[model samples]
Target: MSDVTTPKRGRPGYDQAAILEIAVLAFNEYGYDATSMGVLASRLTLSKAAIYHHFSSKEELLQLALDHALGGLEGLLLEPGAATGAAIDRLAHVLRGAVHVLADRLPYVTLLLRVRGNTDVERQALTRRRAFDRAVATLVTAARDEGSLRADIDPAVVTRLLFGMVNSIAEWYRPTGPTDAAHLANDVLAVALNGLRTPA
Candidate 1:
């Protein structure tokens, strides 16, 4: 007598992951608020019931997508490069990892950046995002204290500026574009860590 029943399958070729991918793409293409189960079903060419078989609601899909993006970011902080290095190096590692995450999971990360906290799921994602930001800010502070970073600028402002640049990549970066993630990360670091003003 096994209490665990086997999970039911949805329509062939449309597992939960596949459905989630399409749903997140829709959420990014249209506004999440405007993307309903009906809209997702129409996009998937499946009945609403089939969609429900995969997800309980649009919000569930959203929560999963947000987690997908946030998880990538949060994991970066725990990496060896991020954890056991000089703060400046750690910061660089995290930023580079972010670019890779964005390149690998573009739609999910895009949706994460666009979240407005309209729902509980959105709010939770925003909270996790803020925590990530704070971690970066702390690293900035450490690097500054070590005299590796400019101290004149506030660390919080530096964090904002650094991430502002990193986040902007989502707007223009294309996987098919000339710049790959490693080169883009290098360019970002060169500009951000070094500076436009030539040394005297």
Candidate 2:
């Protein structure tokens, strides 16, 4: 029903980036399984053939979104600023960074958070999410080992609880809310790390 024909590699004057943006919105609005190539084509004012030329399938589009959302998050941990701090301090810095990352990648990550593990693509995304959490758990372990954290519960438990508190931010956090991401992260860290029950 569209006049657009497929260009070589589907250059429709819209590159991979534009498709990614539009596709993320579609996935968010319709869920990955419910969205089809035709739906994307309809929205883009391009042919289904054109959408396919740029992306192998709907799954591929989801993968690209995941990479963009999660990649930015993994980068903060490796930054030199995250390197020199004590474990708790580094943990705070990383949390702060995560809030910014979440804000930056809000829609992509929002769709990421909503996935129900109904498909292989969703399952793989879940695995990657767990992997990122484990990395932060390692920081909790380091803090416990260095005696900076109170010893009682396992480091893994603390990390789980910490993320439980952090992950919910997506559900309620708004870019134009009364508060900003950085302050929210500090508050989250304080409650998760400081509000814990200690032997003291």
Candidate 3:
């Protein structure tokens, strides 16, 4: 037997994606401005130097987290269903996709939603978010033109209302919750496109 027993190996090292997930959770819990690299290191049980090995600075981590959230939303626009269907159907498909992205990427989406244009990274995220909103509004305009959506509401206003409903999910949605994304998407479409009052 050796004079001393071999020490057990420590936890596996974290990769960029794993670090990003932790960073998003920390940022979500303590707002990006309030979080620091030291705080993140403590949360991750790694030294500041170790974290620096992966990310140059806290801002870099913020950017990567925003990219994760924005990528999901941007990818939704490129899907075939979003581009080829009837305008109303496309609009519904996009809304459904948005809901799924929100639920699946809840922490990152929540962080993205909370950004206030205070920093360069945040401003860029906001710009991307607004662009996505505008794209959805275009679908609303198309749907209205097809007489499938209510013309009484301006497409811009409809776009805002639709997203307002969807974005509110970040406040209360949970991945482990009873409701899944598909059911939530259907509920959203029913209320948004079909309205609340029963047809007489």
On TM-score, the candidate that comes out on top is 3
> Could you estimate the TM-score for every candidate?
0.91, 0.82, 0.91
Ranking by lDDT: 3, 1, 2
Q: Which segments of model 3 are wrong by more than 4 Å?
A: 1-11
Candidate 3 C-alpha RMSD relative to the actual structure: 8.2
Clashing pairs in 1: none
lDDT values for all models: 0.86, 0.79, 0.86
Cα lDDT of model 3 by residue, 1-200, tens digit: 01111123344787766777788889988888889999999998999999999889999888877887888899899999998979998998899999998998888889988889998889999999999999999999999999997778889988998999999998988878899888899899888988877976
Output the better candidate (1/2) by lDDT: 1
Off by over 4 Å in 2: 1-13, 116-118, 196-200
For all predictions, the C-alpha RMSD in Å is 5.3, 6.6, 8.2
| Residue range 64-102, candidate 2, lDDT tens digits | 788776777777788876777788888877778887878
